[model samples]
Target: MSELLLTVKELKDIEKYSADGYVLGYEKYTFFGASRFSYDEIASISNKANVFVLLNALIHENNIEDFNSEINKLAKLDVNFIVQDTGALSLILKQISPKRVVFNPYTMICNKNDFSAYQNEGILGIGISSQLFIEETIELSKLDNALILLYGYEPIYQSNRKVLSLYQEAKKVRFPNGQLYLREDTRDVLYSIIENEYGSVIFNCKKVNLIRRIKDIKEAKYLLIDTFLSSEDEIDNVIKELNE
Candidate 1:
């Protein structure tokens, strides 16, 4: 368990970031900001650092056949798989090592009871829900083999429907293809959202920026920093801070 940076070369100096490893989104299974690396690229990155692939997309029925095919190709690489969907987990288990497959269904796991149950089911590790407040999260970090997606806007909701597309069509307006945020009339907070062919995902308004507390939360095995929605300067600052 080391620091993980979720990114693509969209940010420079990833190798110089000094993270325990680098994380890339699986083109077919991971959501927004997916690096969409080719198989040769996957092999290349693994040689540089430990590679973690996020298969966090809620797999649609039609994509299963193709996604499963991608899993087979990925299994040959020395990379760890972090998955959200149960069906995707089952697919990885069929080909990847159990130790390398991590179950990370966001916001579903909160307390020790839920975590214990997943452990009982033979899941080696799981990402702790970011919904838990600071003190509560510190307590859960005491548990063995836990991981925290400490910094970044965690995706709170995902749907198979193209909500944004429907909105654009109905309104007859175009939104930028880059990240967009939705805000309620009275609320100051804005929720980040993006839509692709797989679906739309709404991210938490308040990012879980806990980089400053890294030393205090030593019991947790892994701490993750996501670079999505961040510029090279932003992520560069983060990496420098973490290593300091």
Candidate 2:
């Protein structure tokens, strides 16, 4: 059976609810961080919760050293890391080891070959792409170490450029939370945008609600729930639905 892995966006979630298996977004590139958390802050949260750190930031050559340093520090906590960048993976493999690594290149592992390559690399677990059809996911879940995204906004675009910041400045408005939205000119689709020190990432407007389909992926190792840009009550309701 797969475990429900909730995303800890706010300290209030930690205070109000007990997340035995949780993932924390500590830096700017992730879901929670309009305000970045220090390593000490991360440690404080991990001490109270069973935490897995999300280092899904898009790493470039310029930030490789800084990224490596962060990973090295996180290794001391003895928590697993969910990595996106290849450079970050190399650092983890060298400094940490594949045992503590969970590879999630946001919508990249779509087929069996991808799964095999990752498994051969000694990766302990891998995230299935959110963009894949349910049938593809069902086929891939048979792989023993698959991690499926059971609920969340699917990430569509990510870039190091501060697109949201520039747009906010041009519009003469500050989105304090550093979140905004863009709608298609032809279609009625809206995409959520989050910008910070690391860069900007745009996600699908509608949340992916697979609470009803959990049985389809029970053979997997983990089921991820990303609670970004949601209210406290809304999050609680989702959790309640999952439990039922």
Model 2 TM-score, 2 decimals: 0.89
lDDT of 2 at 32: 33
Off by over 4 Å in 2: 18-20, 28-36, 167-178
Q: Which of the numbered candidates is closest to the native, going by highest TM-score?
A: 1
Please, what are the lDDT tens digits per residue for candidate 2 over residues 1-244? 7766777766666676554467776663353322345678788767667677888887878878887887888889857787788788888887788988888887789999989888888886898888888888888988978888887787888877798778778999876664568888988887888766777778888877777877887888878877777676888888788767
The Cα error of candidate 2 at residue 202, in Å, is 1.1
Task: Tell me the whole-model lDDT of each prediction, alpha carbons only.
Answer: 0.76, 0.77
For residues 89-110, write the lDDT of model 1, one tens digit per residue: 8776666666777788888889
Best by lDDT: 2
Error of 2 at 13 (Å): 1.8
TM per candidate: 0.90, 0.89
